[model samples]
Target: MKCLLVSDSHGSETELSEVIERHRGEVDAVFHCGDSELSNDSSILEGVHTVQGNVDKPGEFPEDTAETVKGVRVYVTHGHLYNIKMTHIPLSYRAEETQARMACFGHSHHPTAFEDQGILFVNPGSVMQPRTRPEQTYAIASFDESGGAEIRFYERESAEEVTDLYASFPAGTQ
Candidate 1:
């Protein structure tokens, strides 16, 4: 299964809609890690698994969510609640508690993907206002039956892969 992960749009509805449209039908699922600054009923969020961010209105969205996609258990969150800017330990523990093989989140707007103790943690960065890199980014993750997984980053505006930001985990990692 393949899934799209994005976050921190910070109110750029146009960019968010474009990214979703660009990957429509190309992935099994779509996840937004928050700070979208859009209403819960926004059309752009239809069918998207989203979480509330620090800036989002309280009670509009859940703080975290978990779901199984094609046999892969994924946990989604905005990261602020888990103190991601300081360390991923808390977030990792939460994902473990959820029995999720992948933990998707965003907050720092720094695109990153890595595996920690058999769990994959990915941050797709900010599509509207990027921090570390100049290009607004998002991530596409693919999972196979044998536990093989790979994450690839893309430039949101161009829908082009960022070849250098790819990460692949061996079957046994999960």
Candidate 2:
């Protein structure tokens, strides 16, 4: 299964729509890690599983959520509550508690893909404002039947893969 993960669009509805359209049939699900700044009625988030970021108003969105995709349990959050910029320990613990194989978040606007213990942690960066790199980015996580996963980061508008920012891990480890 393939899932598209994006974050921090901060109200660029056009770009968000484009990304969703571009991967419409290519991926099984679309996850927005938050800070979209768009209201719940916005069409841009029609089919996206999204969390609320610190910038978002409360009551309309959930702070975090969990889902199972292709037999992999995934935890999705905006990361401010976990102090993600300083450390992933808190988020990792939450993922483990939920029995999630992967965790997706955004807050620092930095793109990262790494494994801790047996769980995978991914931050697709900010589509509107990036900090770790110049290019605005998102991530595509693909899981195969053989119990393996590959995560690839891509430039949002151009849809070009950021080859150097990729990570892979075997399945059944988390």
Candidate 3:
């Protein structure tokens, strides 16, 4: 299945709607890593799974979530819960505890995609912050039952990419 990962869109429904409408048939699911500042209304999210971010007010999510997607054990979180900016050591430890194949998070407002410990770690960056790079970005990860993972980084609003980096892992590693 193909999933779109976005974050730190503090109420850009235009981009949200455009992305959903544009990727209508391309991806199976859209995951928003919060800081959305939007309510739980279906219209804004239309076809996405969203979690709360630091600025996302109250009652969005407790902390983290673990789920199985396309036969891959996936974990999603905002990363602020564990003070991740200073280091990934703690984050890696938490991921190990979850037994997840891929972990997704946002908070650094920087796009990253890589494999570590046989798992994929992705950060979709901030859709509204002053990023270190020129393009405000988001991520898309496609995975099959065979555990092959493909990652694409897209520039916000442009619908294109600043880079195209891909990687995959063997199945049953997590």
Top TM-score hit:
1
* Candidate 3 wrongly placed segments (more than 4 Å): 164-174
- Residue range 88-164, candidate 3, lDDT tens digits: 66777777799987788888887887778877888888777736676778878888767778788887788886665
TM, every model:
0.98, 0.96, 0.87
lDDT (Cα) of model 2: 0.91
In Å, residue 121's CA in model 3 sits off its true spot by 0.4
Could you say which candidate leads in lDDT? 1
The alpha-carbon lDDT assigned to residue 132 of candidate 3 equals 67
Residue 129, model 2: Cα distance from true site in angstroms? 0.5
> What ranking of all candidate models by lDDT puts the best one first?
1, 2, 3
Q: Whole-model Cα lDDT per candidate?
A: 0.94, 0.91, 0.76
Clashes of 3: 0
| lDDT tens digits, residue span 1-174, model 2 | 899999999989899899888997899899999999999888888888999999987866899999998787899999999999899999999999988888999999999899888888999998889986999999999989876899999999789999999888987665
Q: Model 1, range 12-122, lDDT digits (tens) per residue?
A: 999999999899789999999999999999999999999999999888899999999999999999999999999999999999999999999999999999999899999
Candidate 1, residue 106: the lDDT equals 97
